[model samples]
Target: AEIGKGFLLPSASISSKTKEQMPAIPKEIERAEEEGVKILYLTLPTEITGKNGRVNGLKCVPLVLDEIDAEGRRKPLPISASEFLLK
Candidate 1:
């Protein structure tokens, strides 16, 4: 399984640059869906110093080079996000 981090932020309290750095959750979900993945797990850090308990940063998604896609593009399988958060 792959592992990574994700950040969360309040609606109007985070910087634009920080927001830009965050990964697109919808895209991740989409990619997983395309693969026929049965489960999607996410880890949300409980304690954060900025923006009143909201997250503002995320680690890069851990991907495994499993195979090539229909377009001759290498596809990666991501680790479960739940494992990290529950810990």
Candidate 2:
């Protein structure tokens, strides 16, 4: 489980992704203070890449929901988008 989330563990990390990669991210870092998130590192998901360098999506669910052994991480219900990083 520790290895699975290794990429996000660093304090100051740099990731390279365009809007095409993950539509969730902002396109430009115009003002560092303007955006709420202070990015530390970049993480590359295990997915196929197209010629355009865009992610083709994951083949599997990554980990089976039933296989999750961490009790704290095992959410009884789906999490809201706002509190996603907290848990």
Report each candidate's C-alpha RMSD, comma-separated, in the order given: 14.7, 14.7
Instruction: State every prediction's TM-score relative to the real structure.
Output: 0.26, 0.17
Q: What are the per-residue Cα lDDT tens digits for candidate 1 across 1-87?
A: 022213232222121222223355767645654544423232223333335676544433334444667888554455456322211
lDDT of 2 by residue, 1-87 (tens): 223345653222223333233334344442332433444222322334354776433221112122335564322232123221211
> Top lDDT: which candidate number?
1
Backbone N/Cα/C clashes per model: 2, 2
lDDT of 2: 0.31
Which residue pairs clash in candidate 1?
2-79, 8-55
